[model samples]
Target: MRRTAISTTVLALTFLAVPATAQAQTQYTGTNAPIKVTLTVQGPDGLLFKGKVRTKGHDVTPATGGTHTCDGTNAGANPSPVPTPTAALDDAARVNGFTWDGTWYASFDDYLVESVKGVKSDATAYWNISVNGTSIPVGGCQFKLNAKDTVAFTWTTL
Candidate 1:
């Protein structure tokens, strides 16, 4: 009879402990955590342009020209052609701690430039969305016509 009572008590304690353990496990599911990120882009003359981008949802913004703003969704429209550098060596120093070569040029369109190491030209440009720094690989966003002479691109977190 004593053994039976002890077994019963042990079973009850185990049942009580199970729920507490399960509850602790559920708290770490991480379903409500926010994602963090950083973005960077390089231009001519060591001009490093950086922006804080969020990945919560879709967002769109206007494009910029070298000097003055342009019209229509396509900012590349007849933009004042800036002289492209003869060699990558004559470009500005890499911005945001990344080293790059060659003269950088800005288009009427919005693009991102990614930094790489070892390669002669460690900078590459994306059409719509570009990865500028070392961070999560967010996909590229495309440019759309917002209004007359206004174009925008939207990036979203997946």
Candidate 2:
């Protein structure tokens, strides 16, 4: 009986001495933070349009709607804003070395389709854009315009 007690005490002590193999497990890494990119488009006027594009991995929130600050030169310029498109074409023309002149559509069908034809200063690419966001992808850049990138365009009414 004494030997049995001693062995039980030893086993208990051994078990107590052994550190608990399982502790609170925590996941402290491999988290992705959200990314935001702003794309501003201006025409003959100042601050034509501004958009905010945001994305996390494959999830993206394209531009839904925004106001356009029509210049005095534009007809019926009374803050007659329009619906913005979810995405715009980031087109580049080859003639002027990567000049961007792309076009963007609006969420509302009535709004005039924006036609952008300019040179992207940052990339030096000439582009010709139309209403729909359609263009050949270049520079391994996926044509995924997030919600943060505000896009705008202007044209003289014929």
Candidate 3:
């Protein structure tokens, strides 16, 4: 009984010594405390992917989405407003996106999808983004996301 009491006291002190910021970090860690969301990728032929993916809110990462041909490398990249781990294009890319091609447009400080799942955007047709069935004014990388939100990418024409 005496040994157990001493061990418990030490454990309690160790936990108390930890800083508040460090304990809170787990909530901000994208993979550690993830948020669930819906992702829908609609191709010209049909739907490419639809499922739930885990994501997190974060401080805006400039020019971030992936490490592909056109991801997170713009000279004019700027961080978006901090909301809970944003589930924009970066989340889709992390979850179920494939073979994506996008451009980090410094003019808009956003990312535009040029191709995804082998489908390319043409002069007439392009990939558009909608959150919960409403079209977004900003690029996919700039759009914010919330839990249970449905992010849809549809291939369409002007």
Candidate 4:
């Protein structure tokens, strides 16, 4: 068999085996145990929150600035988000020993973490969320975390 053809077949099989994200359940099935992960919140001032946190849930308030475009343009009209488990970065960030704030963006169906500790996103800087040192296209609240995932919210600029 040709090398290119063999690789193509293998790649196709891998895609077929991987379940869709919306339908897939995590490895820890049927268990409500908190997803413990390392969380870091770095603002312009300095590191605000750094420690392990629980992704099970939190009593903190939901992001309240209506919505924002991917480019950080606020949508102006705040819509009350339906209560649900963001169950990802937002869930884990609820702890880490710092007060966090964010706003829900319907455009992405995720929460854009706006402020950490006392530092807030402004015309000059914003919170950039990364997992394992890589920036992802989706919002933190949408990105599922595995155990030991290094979730960092670093202050960034345009």
Best by lDDT: 3
Note the residue pairs that clash in candidate 3: 56-85, 57-84, 57-85, 58-85, 63-72
lDDT at 132 for candidate 2? 28
> Estimated TM-score per prediction?
0.22, 0.22, 0.59, 0.58
lDDT of 1 by residue, 43-135 (tens): 333324343322321222212212211121222321222211100111212223434322112331322322222222221221222222212
Q: Would you list the rank order by TM-score, best first?
A: 3, 4, 1, 2
- Cα displacement (angstroms), candidate 3, residue 128, comes to 0.7
> How would you encode candidate 4's per-residue C-alpha lDDT over 91-155 as one tens digit per residue?
54444344567655355444656666668776556677667797543434433456667778788
Best by TM-score: 3
Which runs of model 2 end up more than 4 angstroms from their true locations?
Answer: 1-34, 56-158
Query: Which portions of model 4 miss their true places by more than 4 Å?
Result: 1-33, 57-60, 63-97
Give the alpha carbon lDDT tens digit for every residue of 1-158 in model 2. 65345433432332234333311111112222333545444554454444444433221121233333211111221122212222232221122222332221222111222234432212212222222233211110112233344333322221
Q: Model 3 residue 111 lDDT?
A: 47
Worst 10 residues of 3 by lDDT: 69-78
Q: RMSDs, each prediction?
A: 24.0, 27.5, 20.3, 13.2
